[model samples]
Target: MNRTNCGYPLLFPRQNWRHYALRSLQFAVALYLLAFFLFPVGFLFLKALQNPDGTMGWGIIALLFANPVSWESLQNSLIVATGAACLAGSLALAAAALFWKSDIRPSPFMELCGFLPLFMPAFVLASSLDIIVGGHGGLPAMLQNLLGISRANASLLSLTLIEALHYFPFILIALHLSTRASSPQAHAMARLGTSWRRLIRQVFVPLALPGLAFAMALTFLKVIDDLATPLALGITNMLAPQAYHRIAVYGAQDPLAALIAAILFITSGLAWFASLGFIRQNVNLFPVTFNDNRPPPTSASMRGRFFITFLGVVYLGCYAGLILSSLAGVWSHTPLPETYVLTHYLKAFRFEMSSLYNTLIYCGFAALIDILVALPLAHAIAKAPPHWKQRLGWLVAGTLCIPGVTLGIAYLALFRDIQLPLSNLPLDATGLLLTLAFSIRGLPFALHICSLALNSVPASYIEAARTLGCAPAKIVSRIVFPMLRFGLLLAFTLCFSLAAVDLSLAALLVPNENNAPLAYSIYLHIQSPSGMNVGSALAIISFALLALILFGIIHRLHRRQGSHRTLSPPLFPTHRTTGFAHESSHH
Candidate 1:
């Protein structure tokens, strides 16, 4: 028997080591999900059932349903969510179909327009729209004169439209990706003399259904979970706002708040479960291909381009009030500000620097955690057996069903009595808990992107490295990391941005005003008449900073790609390959 240094046996030693390492990593991921994600949420449900006497019962839920306001809130939430989903889905489908079926190309500017909403908080958009049309002023006056509608009706319409606008991009992106995935089938059908309607129905629709369903479901969930938008619009007859009211007025220890959160969780979970079947049908087997050799653009294509540009302009125009408010020195009952100054911006930096610091510390930590956890988790899921793969993937995706407010409520309930190690302060009161909440909330997104990144790397590269006696860590560091750096950076940026704008969690989890994150601080500022300009200033600053960061990251990644293309190492060295082959032959 031949023995290697520090090895018990050489026979299948690599296999043994690899198996243990994989198992250990999987176990670690499982433990993390259980501890941070499952445990807290489970505790919330349990707490909702706990009676004042410390016995388990459904009395809290019974009480919740008994209240007329609660029932109305539930109905309103359902209506808004469903309406927003349908509206957004319709717009996204139309835009996607036009781009896919027509000669019109989606410009980078169009893509940026779709992506912009993801970084903007729902409340910010709601507030901006309110400024434009909330009261009997400006756009609202003109609309009322033209349409003859009451202010109350207009408010409700604005709320629904705001939600739809904020979420349409999700469906658009999904449909766009689905089109790419189904391109080959589409081309084949076209070549076979298929009718336009038949090709669309048979090839495009079926392939896009999964993505469409998932996106609609996601939009519905987001709308349902949104607390800030309703609150900002002064629409309290919604589930999220009601839940926040319960907590805010009755405190975190309130059983009714827990009950409302539990209901929200159940509602979102059902929606997610309904969409799971569609999600499971998604298959990506080919690279995305575009019609690069198309003929000259026609009138229809020109119309399509014009329509897309119009949509982008309209969406950006929605933020005109916000931009003006940020720059305004004074304005009262006017279409625009009377004077413009940098005073608001100066005030935001002077007094709200702590909020910025807190946001960076909390969201930055969360994004880091997401990348670290998602990298291994994505790899493990990719390597998992088919049955386990589906299960693990759904499990990660299920995090979407756990709303930010639900998680925040859960953390407050679960960790109310739990203290940080060696500290007298409760665990729920610290920024650590907030960071963990952000991580859990952002994990699904990070996981999805990381999975895509991992899938892009060929399996043969990893296997070759292993066969060349490179350790798993070395394989990832040398081969996987280099290839995945861009994707990882993108995931980090996305997670950080998402976490930063998450007003629901920040509202519930913020320890105090002094330590509040920027989103929560902005919310506070918006609530005050004197602070409205400062709030707008803060929002604008946040947006500009995020945009600058994203631009820098993209530029860096592009530069790195160019450098790598010109001066990169061989993916697999010839000498190492020969040695590995020789060793295999000897064995």
Candidate 2:
């Protein structure tokens, strides 16, 4: 008998090799998720429960809740989070609605204003506002003299407004996309004699709820988990800063810090779960078609144009103090600086080069790792069976609940004693751990884009290639990779930018000041009176660098496509039935 035809062949048959390869790939992905994500987070929870004698109990958690400061911090975090979400959502909803009704074409400058906050760190916003309104700020004396407002009260008010301003774009983008998706319905309703109010009440609200809920939930999580902003504002009573303080002062092994991190984790997870519930209820809202065939406006309404311009100007005006601080020589008590100079910029370049380099190296590696893992994970989810697809999608989405501080704490706790190969240093002592943390944090974003890209590819093309007996490697390299190049590029850019601006992770994960990322370095500089100008200069440089990188990537992409295609706003996935629903069913 031929060995190949035997019931038990020595080697696997050629036809079944692909199946084995796929199984191996799935196994590898599962292992990676467990090792990098599940274990660290799980250990953090365990650390919070463990007693000093190594016994497992709830004593630490109980002690945490028993403290009045902890209760106060928790209450403050919830209040701030809720308020910021509402404010951001309201602003975005109004802006999006106005734009939709007027059909105004946004200028490139307007577009930049709307999206600029996404590329900046929240602390930068907080600091900029402080420079304008703090006790020793340029405008505080002037404002106090004219408006009868104290700098103290203004600083308090600015904290929430700063967060709201920084995060509103997320909701704005979501609302814009949802409006486009539901435009046909709106027009249909309008043609049937439906009033504007009724149309908004019935069709617009329901269609927009999924996107709004997801975006607002995201905002809430961001505000609650934000460490640098609260710290920069000198508001250490919030949960994030409290946890950071405990870890920084008491060491990573502090039980109170672990408990506080646990609280933050639970709170974030609950918020995310709530958003998913809202998304589930509105699963049928999105239309499959993405194109908008409406004619470009030849002349926008004067009122609409004025409103757009006013908002753009006001938003950009918030950063005026930051610009001046970077260039100002002195005259802090005046409305403007006495003299302008390049000394701050020169100092930033001289002393902060290491910090800037650290950011690029760490965030760049993290982005690379994100795309590498995201491609296979996205493909696997697309090809999974219905039940498994939902499970895998949720598993990936769960990564968003892991706050940066919590993840950093988990890394320190879980990997503290694990020595690196061929080195005496522990894993937590090197930049590798920081890069890995960033990768885990950014995986969900990368996966979302990758899945969308993979969904765009025609199944028939893949099936035909398979019919020709092309190997999986050949299919991916020859066909899939070419189509996925743009999406991969976008994923990398998003991950890199997000990581670079992550002050929370950098604050907690850096082993020493020498290895600090630019965000942390800026924070340190700002804390010193003499170094404030240098910090402001560094912040501007960071902003410019990120903007240039993004512009270059987008320009290159445009040239490659041989068209002036603008970027499409990113869409958030609703529950199992909307975004990934199509992905799962595409095959």
Candidate 3:
């Protein structure tokens, strides 16, 4: 027997039943991943390449190449993505340095505020911008008067601005974690009398290059694949909205939509792979021991204070605009609303009260499914034979790079009329299909969180239990489950909130208003002429509820973990350095 470090055999299965069970579980997981993810994506390519008569069609490919709008959409996507990536990454880098590295007052609250937009759905932010900047024509009018810019130009800029704000948190968190990981090196460099600027240039930036690249790549992919922002802003010429528009106008029969989806799929896939490569290549560039010893905060500079204050004002303005827009009755010509009214909320609730139930039910089911499936999957990967671990990890992470829009389109193409296994029920009936879609979309997040939790558990603890003659089932229940409770809670909450606010999946997978979650409902409201205020109201409510629940749970988890262990690594891979990047760097 090949005994392992934990006193278990390298190939631990002694009973035939256990081996059969493990094989069965692996088979089931593989089947689901293939059917839901890989096969559907492959089907999307087939649909993109096929003629109306179900035969191969190369003419559509040529049409995509020749169409001016297709080319323009692609161009606009590249421009927007590049611009958003640069802006977001730069802003995040600056903000992370001030809030985390400097000796700022109320650092915890500042960090939370910085992270607020990550939990907010993009549509909510878009609606808020429309209300403050475009709905009343206040900011656009002011810009027109001062700079001779047109309202259309103002709207586009606002769109870009809001996108950068929404994505800033991804890079901010990434850089924050990466910087913390290299704090010892940073402090050592500081003791050598290195200026902040040079320290960043010589040590911090180089060490955190992987995280910065990952953040930029992730942001670019997100901006290009985003459907809600462009759609809410009435910018149908962009690639994501254009693809969605074709599907809405021509239904599933449109190959052009599939073609556009294929493009997004390829673009996002490449970005995702590039980010992973960067992170892997540089993760150990300046490796340090993980510990709880806190580094002394650096002295705050006047410049850092000013930068932090400016970012705070921006976030406060956006959040306030969202809340006020929901309550404002009208203010066409003035900077402020003419009257504050609660009617919007009243009307919105009257119409969408049922949608609240729908949101809760779908999110609840999605969370349950994610936890159930991801836990076992994480266990299998972490405990697998060493030869199989890397392959299994990659398989779980396969969808991490796929854009939500691409997955939404692929699911629509494949599950439009499919039947559920072992039941007479069709997949598309009564929002069941949407539920499954949300689960699949959120699986990667759940798996990642659980894997971290599982890996954190000591091998000696499990070995001791086994030596005491504990059954595997009992050990899992008494030891592993208890240890993972906080992580599982966090994962479930994140998965549920994500599902509830997923615009891409909800837009395509939801067949009717009854199936619409809060995000899709907000989209429909924003798009309807009579329902914009109602949409704003709904956005406010959803944003508030999500912030409250997620923040409350996360705060409690952090406090508990802080007592004994350190925080988890950043959700996205980004890195930071010695000080705020110079403001001119953004230019």
lDDT of 2 at 480: 75
Off by over 4 Å in 1: 1-25, 134-154, 180-203, 280-294, 466-473, 553-587
Per-residue CA lDDT of candidate 3, range 1-587, in tens? 33442232322356757667776776787787788778988999999998766788787788787889899888778777888888888877776665434523334444454445445576576666556665634444555566778766665665677688788866775666556544455556667987767766765565556667876886787678778877666677778888888888987658888889999989877777766766532222112123335544445545556876776687668766667867888757787888999999999878787888888888889888888788768767756776576566655665766777777788777876778789876676558767877889789889877776676566677777778888877877887777778778878887888788777777777868876788788878877767777877888788678668756764664566545343353332223223333111100
The TM-score obtained by model 1 is 0.85
Full-model lDDT for every candidate: 0.74, 0.74, 0.70
- Give every collision pair in model 3: 174-574
* Segments in model 3 whose C-alpha atoms lie over 4 Å from true places: 1-12, 97-115, 134-155, 181-188, 280-306, 330-332, 346-351, 385-388, 419-426, 562-564, 567-587
Model 3: lDDT equals 0.70
Give a tens-digit lDDT track for model 2, residues 363-423.
9999998987887787677666656776777778777877888888888778888999999
Instruction: Judge candidate 2 against the unseen true structure and give its global Cα lDDT, from 0 to 1.
Output: 0.74
Worst 10 residues of 2 by lDDT: 1-10
User: TM-score, each model?
Assistant: 0.85, 0.86, 0.86
Clashes of 1: 0
Tell me which of candidates 1 and 2 scores higher on TM-score. 2
Instruction: Put down candidate 1 lDDT per residue, 1-587, tens digits, no spaces.
Output: 32322121222244577767766876888798889888988888888898767788977677778889999888888988989899999888877776666545464333444566667688787777767664313344445566889865555566778899888876786677656434444555666987767766765676567668877887888889988877776678887888788888888888778888989999999998887766434422111222355547866568777877787688678888788888987788788889999999999999899999999999999999999899778767655565677577767778788888899998888777888889899987788889999999999878877776766565666666667888767776898778788778878987999899888899888888899999899988876778988998999998889778756754564575434421111111111112102211110
